[model samples]
Target: MAEALADKNRYAHAPRNADWTIDQDWASYTPEEHDRWNRLFARQARVLPGRACDAFLAAKQKLELSRAGIPDFAELSERLARLTGWRVVPVAGLIPDDAFFDHLANRRFPAGAFIRPERELDYLSEPDVFHDVFGHVPLLADPVYAEFLEAYGKGGQRALRRGQLHNLARLYWYTVEFGLLATPAGLRIFGAGILSSPGESVFSLEDSSPNRIAFDLERIMRTKYIISDYQQTYFVVESFEQLLAECYQDFGALYDDLRAQPDIEAHALCAGDRVLTQGDQHYFRARGMAAE
Candidate 1:
């Protein structure tokens, strides 16, 4: 797991502080860097209207995110605070789990301070400023989702103490990173990991290669997830309020009960799942056959 994390964060800039934070130095960004942000923003913006959840789209407009270039964290925080009491803080890269949880618990989001290079435009192992800001900041504008994040952070801290961090991490993965929302129109994306990537953004909603299941708290905590590729399944919530209500409960006993059960594979669907869309497994199966 440590090695996997290292590989995942190989591209992240090293931090100058113990807590993995650094000054954003918004003034120091080169024109090319700003151009990269603009290009990535424009690409995702064009696709998000129909693809992103209504809450996310509304938040994006409310935040006025199309101002071009990377956002100033100070300015972004000011605007976000006004809307939802959330603040965006600059981080050198991915920090320790405890530190991350602490930040979220305090209503502060630790965003990467650098942008991805042009050569790595389509893909990056580590989240850059574009992914952090463009993907995550918009959603922070929603009051319910913002509260859910804080609850998640507090839950994370408790989970860490109970040796249930893995379970909590899975919840984070399937929700904040790759969660979906079911609306009257159809399934929409609320996950930052899916929202930021042009390919995954489309593939998550339109493709027939991944499972779309209703958000079951225990089921999600028990399910495993993949980091190197697109998700095999996405847990969908009815609304941000639903997500918050589900997570706000006491997890102490739940964590104790979960420790006795075996983990479910990323691609395996358990019986009694409020299954929405059954996936073909085309993507993973093809990859497996290629490996064989």
Candidate 2:
């Protein structure tokens, strides 16, 4: 941790403020970077139509994210603030957890100022501006989801104080980053992790290899997550209101109990789970086979 804080290279692209925000310096992005953004945008455009939730698609259009290459944070935030009192701010990269919770708590979404290099276009563990803005910022326009995220942000601060950040992160991982939604048309992608990925954009909805289960607050907190590959399971929320209602629950006791319980494997199914699809786990099985 000490070494990380002292690393000068981390802050090379943008000067970090006390709060860890940096000016997006929108004009500084090169033509090549802009072209990459366009290429990524076009890729998702082909897959997201029937896959992304209604709110996300609508917000994407309203924000006019496809108008150009990379969007200027100032302009994007201005429009977002009008709709849901949320603002998009630029960060050097990943900020400390406390700072991140603070930003979300205050309706400020801290996006990475950098875009991934051309070689890493297909997938990246570290979020880039495209993932932050293209994947997350759109949903900030939905009033209910906006309220839920702010509440989650405030909850994060409390979770940190209670030494429950690990548990809290699963909720975020399952829902915020890789969540799905149950719709009449079928399951749709809502997670920025999926919305921004050309591969996940299709696999998440169409593939039969991952478990799809209904969203349960306690269950989500109990489950482990995969960081390096597509998830072994996906949680589906009924609606934004359904998701927002989860924020109203008292998590103090929940956290305490969870500390005493063992974590559920990412691919394990519990008795109470409302199974949407019983994934064959073929993806993981195939990977295991290939490794051997």
Candidate 3:
């Protein structure tokens, strides 16, 4: 009981409700905090126009996310709901996986209420208001992408029941966080993690250091990912509709098959992979994590 009480207190902000949501309290942000937001916004703004997906860019413009300062959830929600029936809700920080899946399942995006410190603007270890709102919120305005997310939310429980949540998590990580999209114009960014980071915005598309593989449900589930730094590989989707159709299914059979197969290392490519770029692996070699 004592430990449970202690864990609950760790939230430490925003007076959380049952859903683990807290008030954004837009008024509480300081001038310095808003300045950090603008700086982060400005960096991504310069890089995104040529790199980010047409769909994501269109939705971002439609939602008017380019304006100054941290967005007020109340105002952002009003605009987003009008477009796709989805709304952004503020969270104290990282909520439980169940709560996260539940929020997405119900069309509520649980964004971190606080902004990252000024010192860590270049790289924040956890998802902050900028990463959540700037990286993710715009895609929520796209109908096809938005529907895919909701479907992913609804399918979470079955994976949990099968004890294959890790596999399911890879789906989100590969697609939503680090995904790339192939366009007639060329490969464009869609994943929030890539779209938001100024450094990676160029690396994921132009650096030729990471494997850009075509999206495959089984392959992504079997593969590992990097969190602390850039991905050694990125999966590219043909379209949001293609991703939705691929994932919208009973995965019991897939789970059974995957349980018997070995997990792939983060940077390794398979013989069967539809490789777009084989990746020189120059970056990982410099770090001594990849050889051959």
Provide the lDDT at 2 for model 2.
Answer: 52
Candidate 2, residue 103: the lDDT equals 98
Query: All models: lDDT?
Result: 0.87, 0.88, 0.89
- Compared with the true structure, what per-residue lDDT tens digits does model 1 show for residues 1-292? 7674444443244445665677788898889888988999899988888889998989888888884898999998999999999999898677899999999999999998788866679998888898899888889999999999999999999988988999999998998989999999999999999999999999899989888999999999999888888888899999999999999988988898898989998888889998899898898788882111
- State each model's C-alpha RMSD to the native: 3.5, 3.1, 3.2
Model 3 bad stretches (over 4 Å) = 1-11
Model 3, 1-292: lDDT tens digits are 7564333323344488888998777898888878888988888888999799998889888888864898999999999999999999998788888888899999999998787776677888878888999999999999888999998998887788778999999999999999999999999999999988999999999997899999999999999999888999999999999999999888889999999999999899998999999898999899887758
Residue 15 lDDT in candidate 2:
69
Which runs of model 1 end up more than 4 angstroms from their true locations?
A: 1-18, 289-292
Clashes of each: 0, 0, 0
**How does model 2 fare in lDDT?**
0.88
Best by TM-score: 3
**Can you rank all candidates by lDDT, best first?**
3, 2, 1
Question: How many steric clashes does model 1 contain?
Answer: 0
* lDDT by residue for model 2 (1-292), tens: 6554334223344568999998777887789889989999988899899999999999998888993889999998999999999999999789999999999999999998788877678877788888999999999999999999999899999999998999999999999999999899999999999999988888888888888999999999999888888888999999989999986666998998898889998888999999999888888888772111
RMSD (Cα, Å) of model 1? 3.5
Q: In candidate 1, what residue range of length 10 has the lowest lDDT sum?
A: 4-13
